[model samples]
Target: MGLAVSGGPDSLALLLLAHAAMPGNIAVLSIDHGLRLEANNEVALVEGICLQLGVPFTGVRVDVGPGNVQAKARDARYAALARWAQEDGVGAIATAHHADDQAETLLMRLARGSGMAGLAGVRSWSSLPNSDIPLIRPLLWARKGELEALVGDAGILAVNDPSNSNRAFDRVRVRDHLAKHDWLDAEALASSAGHLAEGWRALEWYAELDWAEMVAPDPDAAVQPALQYCVNVPRTIQIETVCRIIAELGGRVTRSEAGRAADRLWRGNNASIGGVLAMAGVEKVAKVGVEMRVWRFSPEPPRNAH
Candidate 1:
């Protein structure tokens, strides 16, 4: 496995500790976006650190100057990591994101009226399409404070990324606000998110049961087994069932919208999730079919995946 080293304090601490523990088992992968003049220097610093620790180092430079800087940079960084791992025949890719990042993600998604999936935050492991390789998070249980404290306890200096403090970013907004609340709220929020995720899982489990019994494969949207498998499920389990089916078939679902629509399946005669519209046609056999939302004839695998 490799650590994505940006010279940030938490990542640096993770790198140092991983080296101290695993020794030769781990290496550092640094990507320079060339956004600042000091970017390359930052990579050099991480490389020097790796050399001192007798760990191998590889550096990649990405051109992320167009489109959304943050989004494109993230895409490029992961793409480089995935490419390097594939070439090296590595089993996994490790990132520096910690519990704090997860918490912030949950909060942001919640503020946007996200459902359980968003609140669950990113999973610790992401399975690559048609590959056994996965993106793994070793620091999932660690917090930014713990990682920072590691650096301080070891008497090591780690560079701070100024972009983290900029309020222009939505993450910064959530992070800054999370900076003020008591641990009770933060921990409670996390706990609540966990509960929500559990609920989502349970709902999906029920949906799977329902689908097996009622749904059939569709070849066409207007014909049998044309595009996807169609199910005549009750409004009670519509969105969750749909989301579960989509996920199993390697597709994306809007959790928040879907959850809301599911909640309203009984109250309203019609509800739509991701353009998959459902109307109350029957209740006993749960005869409900989708009309618009998101439907693809065929879906492609995740690009630049592990």
Candidate 2:
């Protein structure tokens, strides 16, 4: 098993527990974002802990370019972990995202008006964008305080990340808001996330059936294989089908992006999303009292040379 450790209380607790549960079979992986002055020291501390525990340790330095720092940092962390997993032949990577994190994620996505997939929030297991290795969150049922208590009980001195309290981040804001609302149970919110995950899975199930029944590679296109889908179904089915097609092409399109693209196609307008072009046929057909929309998706052609 591969454990992602940051020397923080939650992650250190995970490290201790995982090492105890899977002794002699666990590897610890840590990523230094290069943004914090103490990041290198943190990685060193985690490495020393792993060394003391007799577990193999790998430390990676990641560059988080200008953008949403937290989001970009997360992307970089997953990319580094994926590379490490490939090199080590590890099947999965584990993180210590606990119940409090799950609640924060659900609230954040809810505030953003996210759909079921987004509201699912910090799944226990998911694949990173453009990666096949599974990312596992084993401590989703535990709270951050509980994990910190465990670290204290084990006599482990964990590093505190200052950015976690910085109000500039939306997650931090949500965490603070949740903290103020003492009556709101983080565990209940996390349970709602699990329920939403089930709903998302059901949507994917229907989308798969729709894909098998209506979607295919466009054989008539001059360029390489493009996607073609029979879009005579309901709007929800069309949107979900488009998402699936984009996912298949290694393009990650958000729900709103897919919905807008599908809407444009339904309106007989050509749309492009994530380098995937959707063209709607003007000549429509009516079958069984419903108007049929046939849309074809292909890679956007390169611009003409001057």
Candidate 3:
């Protein structure tokens, strides 16, 4: 396993705790996003800690774009860390994402009306996509203050990322909100995100099964590369099924548009998703009818909105 150390108390403590638990089994890695002025010095501090601990260490300085800097830096950081683990033949990557981080992410997703996917929060363990590597988080039980205390007790000074304090960021805003309110209260925030995860899995099973029954292959479905599916598509289930199809291909659809589509299906009116699709042999069937089939396609097109 490899540990992703960012010189922050959370990750640094993770590195130390992991090593103390499994000596000689974990390697420490830090990615310098090069965003803040103190970033280089922070990398140096990480190196110093790794040296004193006799742990193998490496660093990467990334020039993430100014606009969307956080997103870009996060992407680049993960890419670099994953590449490092792969080169070192590490089987998994573990970090210090705790229960608080999970709560914050869930709240932010809730504000955006994020559905099941967002409500589920981060996974405790999962395999990297298209790779043999697994990602793990062991500090899910530790609070941020506890991690900080552990780091201080170890005589390691942590570099505070100012982004954590910035109110402009959604995470910071949500964190502040969670701090002010008692998240344990039922109405305070959805306490069921954990249970929502279970429901999400069950719903996913039903959605996939029902989608297969209601939808069919339509290569020439839409401009966005969706598939076509035939369905009896009861009036009550039309809107939900359309939303499901879009989501199945990782598309974000709004409730208003879903409602319009549903109303069309129930009223037996025409509905179009702005794509001229092809059927068994007939072409340009954007609107599904009684004998008409719904159009969908594979997600291969380049669209910015998605």
The lDDT per prediction is 0.69, 0.87, 0.71
lDDT of 1 by residue, 219-264 (tens): 5444222233333455546666656655554556775565665555
Each candidate's clash count? 13, 0, 9
TM-score of each: 0.74, 0.89, 0.72
Worst 10 residues of 3 by lDDT: 274-283
TM-score ranking, high to low: 2, 1, 3
In candidate 1 the C-alpha lDDT for residue 279 amounts to: 42
Candidate 3, lDDT over the whole model: 0.71
lDDT tens digits by residue: candidate 3, 1-306: 788888999999898898899888878888888778888888889899988888889888877866776788877777787788889888789878877787787877878887666688766777654466788888766678898999999987898898999998988888887778763432223335567777767766665665777676555445544666554544335545677666666665665576565565445454544232222222334454335544443554454885
Ten-residue stretch with the least lDDT total in model 2: 282-291
**RMSD of each candidate relative to the true structure:** 7.1, 2.8, 6.4
Cα-based lDDT at residue 17, candidate 3? 92
Model 1 stretches with alpha carbons more than 4 Å out: 128-132, 183-185, 203-214, 219-237, 240-306
Prediction 1 global C-alpha lDDT: 0.69
